[model samples]
Target chain A: MRKGFRTDLRWSDVTPKEKWLNRRQLMAGAGALVLAAPALAQGTAAPGRYSTDEPPTSLEDISGYNNFYEFGYDKEDPARLAQGLTVDPWSVVIDGLVDRPGTYALDDLLSGVTLEERIYRFRCVEAWSMVVPWVGFELAALLGRVGVQPGARYVAFETLLRPEEMPGQRGGTIEWPYREGLRLDEAMHPLTLLATGIYNEPLPKQNGAPIRLVVPWKYGFKSIKSIVRISLVADRPQTTWNMLQPNEYGFYSNVNPQVDHPRWSQASERRVGGGLLAPRIDTLMFNGYADEVASLYAGMDLTRDF
Target chain B: MDGAASLNGALRRVPVWAVCGLGLVPLAVLVWRGLSGGLGIDPVKTLEHQLGLTALQLLLAGLVVTPLRRWTGVNLIRYRRAIGLLAFLYAALHLLVWLWLDLQLRWSEIGADLVKRPYVIVGMLGFACLVPLAMTSNGWSVRRLGAAAWQRLHRLAYAAVLLAALHYLLLVKVWSAEPLLYALAAAGLVALRWLWRRGRSGTVRA
Candidate 1:
């Protein structure tokens, strides 16, 4: 799977052009196919029309810093502890309110769709933000193929629960097999992706390997990781974070500066990769995807629904 | 028996300056890491957490001094003031990092956090309890306030440590072991002090 590279454009605009051109040339000659955790922004994934022009956070920071509590809670814990997680032989059980009610292999689910490179703004409920270049196809492509039933109103996702592999699950931090769901409309939105990889490489275990949901406009938690089961249900599913603290984390956890979490203000976010001293940027409504996603919540009060 | 006695005597000889200098090592390392880009991806959070954790650790160390003297006869009470001040130093730096670097002087956001965030309010109260203790951490202040009054004022440390632990517990979304352990330590030490007071009064009653 050759990820499209526009190195001559994105990084060239950010840093010196010659640097990226040279790096690309070297990577091309050196066999970039080995999947050795390729360096940051290497073979720059094409920025979607919605993706911000801001340079993607370094692949190291993106991969190393994560909140996949199935691995652990600390930002660094997932990277350190996500080892031994088995992603191969992976099949997703698509059941409940869907025509297709059987376990489908990861390859079978994604057999026909063309993978895209979507550089997206990822804002966590913790008020830390990052730009990621994800390699995947729209989730709606798979949902349409599965055939959502007439009664299906929400799309629920579940992460794998293997205590032997995921150490955090052994602890009582959260109920295992973390669950998240989105309204049917949000699930089928063009921007929603079921990411397979990042920075043009296969998904790292820490960053949700095999398959994961990516709702770019929403807080990062709404994008459940390392999914094993996806259900098209009639009612909204109880998401892990929201179930823990409903007032703090909403079901439709869209990134809104006005609705602050009880732990931290959402008005501004600290962008990673700036070391220690970079100033925080003002958070945008729907994480700057309001134009595309705002109408999904047309009449609903976000503050209340949030 | 001689070896244990000598080890205890050596520990007693450890000076206040050395204790403070050792306590400041984490701060120095933090600043150096911040400058050298070694503080990992989210350096501001790394800085804030390390500073806060170190402060809690130092407070725990200071609290353990009395138990050590009572149980083991280590008699290292002279270092208590330095340890308390060092904890206050890290707490101050932690708050500074949150205000200056993490928030970048977003006063409205800070105000919102104070009002809406339970953890933020608890942490502020913890730090607030430390303020008068920090100011009065001297021989002159003790003489001015009278020993009994000064001792009563310094009982704020008990409240401060509990608040700091609660603040940490609340900050984390889960009741994980790290914050829970800190909260337990804080509660255990305070309970130890209370038990000793009861023991002393029981002797008087007898």
Candidate 2:
């Protein structure tokens, strides 16, 4: 879309996929680290295709801090409480306006497709950020396989709502089975990833195990976690935060520094592991995926929809 | 000689210095946590939030002293100034952390934030109310303004505490028990003050 945009860079130039896969097998054979063994067994993703130049926040910080309200409200609650979650037997139901719609097991769904690493800049609506290396395939790949109908204009998602499993549900703060939606165009964008892991390992339960959506252009909340259902719809679908507080959290929620949150400024963001005195840096529009996704919004008013 | 002797007596009765030491415990713990890496991934935010909460907690503690004296007959009036001053210290630390650590001394941005962020506006209003209170916490100011005027001016604490509590409530994106509990506590303190005034008025009528 613009001169010198990275679309020209081949995947092999960015990442030597074969060597990365071999390294994983080598590590698995040697059993170098106890913690890394199980993660490798699940199939380690090749080095990332699209990587943000920013330093990745530490594995400790990425895993430790989270806003999986299904686990709890506090930042650390998910890491502490999500251990009990059962994700190995997970399945996602696809229905509504699709040619093929059925409940598909996580492993069965991902069996044929290749998962590549995507290093993305994650900007939360709360004005904090991290650069995460997510392992997943493009949502478009899955949508293509499922065959989106001509009538479908929106894609809706739902998170697991088990009260016993997700302790935060007991608080009754938001309607359970957290829901989020995106325009069909947004869903099919190249940057839209259905992530299964981060940091070259299978996602920890706290970090949205099995599967989650990662729309790098939008606020982190729009990347719904621990997804249970995805439905293609004709009408605009309701989202969790939008339904909860329409004024504060909007449907678009594209990370725009100019559009400030009601409680705080979105112009700058604190890097997650950036210690006590770390200076907050300016936030980028569309979380720095403007080249790939900006045209999708074209003439639409993001401020009104945001 | 008599005034000097009464000052000494007041200090001994209330142990104001000891209360001040107790007030510093939160800051000490915060510093210790900072040095030891106990402050999780986002230490800056942890420091900012913990200091603000400490300030609010101390302010709430200061509000309780008047009621404690009235209902339980515990004359802690001497320690009130010490508690109020300590609360101001924490509030000042909170603001400094936000400005220096979070905003990195971007004066123009800070000015913009003050106008844009309602929580910051209310927090600043509470801090503004404290400036006069802290400036006049001494006996000289009481004597200068007359005790009636000084007490009336210090009554701004009730308003400051309310604003600070509101700042916390508005800052939190989610409705949780903790911030709500602080709001309830502040409200309860204000209600107690009103009830005490009503009881005094009834006694005057009698």
DockQ for each numbered candidate: 0.74, 0.68
* TM-score, model 1, chain B versus true chain B: 0.93
lDDT per residue as tens, model 1, A1-306: 222232354423332435544554565568655432343434433334455556778788999999988887788999999878888889899999988789998878777667766889999988899989788888899899989999999999999989999988887858778999999999999999999888666788999997899999999999999999999999989899888888888899889998877677789888888887765999999999999999999999988998
Please write out the lDDT profile of model 2 over residues A248-288, one tens digit for every residue. 99999999998888778888888888788665888998888
Query: Which regions of candidate 1 are displaced past 4 Å?
Result: A1-48, B1-8, B202-206
All candidates: interface RMSD: 1.4, 1.2
- Tens digit per residue, CA lDDT, model 2, B1-206: 55545655665765668899989998999999999999988898899999999999989989987676555555567788998999999999999999999888878779998998899999999999999999999999999999889988998999999999999999887788899999999999988777767778454110
TM-score quality measure for candidate 1: 0.89
Please give me the total number of clashing residue pairs in predicted model 1. 0
Pairs that collide, model 1 = none
Question: How large is the C-alpha RMSD of every model relative to the true structure?
Answer: 5.8, 7.8
All candidates: TM-score = 0.89, 0.88
